[model samples]
Target: MTKIEDVKLIEIPKVKDSRGNLAIIEKDSLPYPIKRVYYLYDVPSDAFRGGHSHIAQHEFLIPLSGSFDVIIDDATNKKTVTLNKPDKGLHIVPGIWRELENFSSGSVCLVLASDVFLESDYIRDYQDFKLSKSR
Candidate 1:
């Protein structure tokens, strides 16, 4: 499992103009490089998502529309980071559990992952995540 030092924050630059603001996340921009890109939205105020940890994947999350916070748990410690700007992204390394919450209305959470979709790579339980990371 990777350590806290492995995680980082990335910023996605937005080109602003009278027409519109455009920001892009490509494979070369991410720390570990991006293999897949996805997004989340329509989250309720009383709800949460991402109570899982990755075994061998890295992710970079950004709030492309409104705002949201990603609470990352490194097993021994936890860090809470809010992403509001479309140009800013938070990088989550492998072996860390993350929970995304407090999404503003009409917010878009974009994720850039280093690996393709693999259900076996995820550790969904907190205790199980910690134990698996220790091994």
Candidate 2:
């Protein structure tokens, strides 16, 4: 079973220059190899996203602009984490349920995924997720 303790906050290395600041995420920095990349943007304040759990996918979430809160549940305990900076990322392991909420306007959430899109890997029902965690 997965636990909230398995979640990690990783600091992305930043290069500061007069022109601008840049942050980088390498394969070695993550627990799983990157196979997919996606971003969330223009989310309304009252909206919620990501009410699902992955059977095998690992993810690293970064707030590139603005901020938001991520609620992670291992079916036994739950925790909320805020992402407000580009230099920080939340590493989410498999078998944990995650929900993204309270997105600030113009927020851009970048997700580095361990695998490509697969419908069969997602557990969309919360009850099903809880049941799976027990087994």
Candidate 3:
């Protein structure tokens, strides 16, 4: 079974130049192969997002512009992590509930997933998720 301890902070490689900075994310650098890539932005400061758990999808979240906090619940304990750097990512494994909150204005959240979008893979109900974890 997956636990909160499985969540990790990953440091992405960054290259600096006279123009600006560049960070690279590839399949080789991640624990799992990347199958889908998406980003979230223009989130309101008072709004919250992502209150679900995945059954099989794993994700890596990166703050490309500003900052936010990710609240992770493992059905045993809850932990909060702040993402504020472009060169770092939070790795979320399956079977854990996550919520993104306290997003700063203009923050951009980049996500890389281990699988394609599948509605059947998501556990959207908190009560249902808790029961699944106990089994």
lDDT of 3 by residue, 3-86 (tens): 999999999998999999899986599989999999999999999999999999999999999999999999999999999999
How do all models score by TM-score?
Answer: 0.89, 0.97, 0.97
lDDT of 1 by residue, 1-135 (tens): 566666677767667899988887665776687788899999986678899988889888888789888888878878888889888888888888899999999999988889999999998878898888677
- Arrange candidates, best TM-score first: 2, 3, 1
* lDDT for each residue of candidate 2 in 74-115, tens digit (9 for 90 to 100): 999999999999999999999989999999999999999999
Native-to-model Cα distance after best TM-score fit, residue 80 in candidate 1, in Å = 0.5
Q: Candidate 2 has which clashing residue pairs, if any? A: none
Q: Is candidate 1 or candidate 3 better by lDDT?
A: 3
Would you list the C-alpha lDDT of every candidate in the order shown?
0.84, 0.95, 0.96
For TM-score, candidate 1 versus 2, the one ahead is 2
RMSD (CA, angstroms), candidate 2:
0.8
For model 3, what is the alpha-carbon lDDT of residue 14?
A: 83
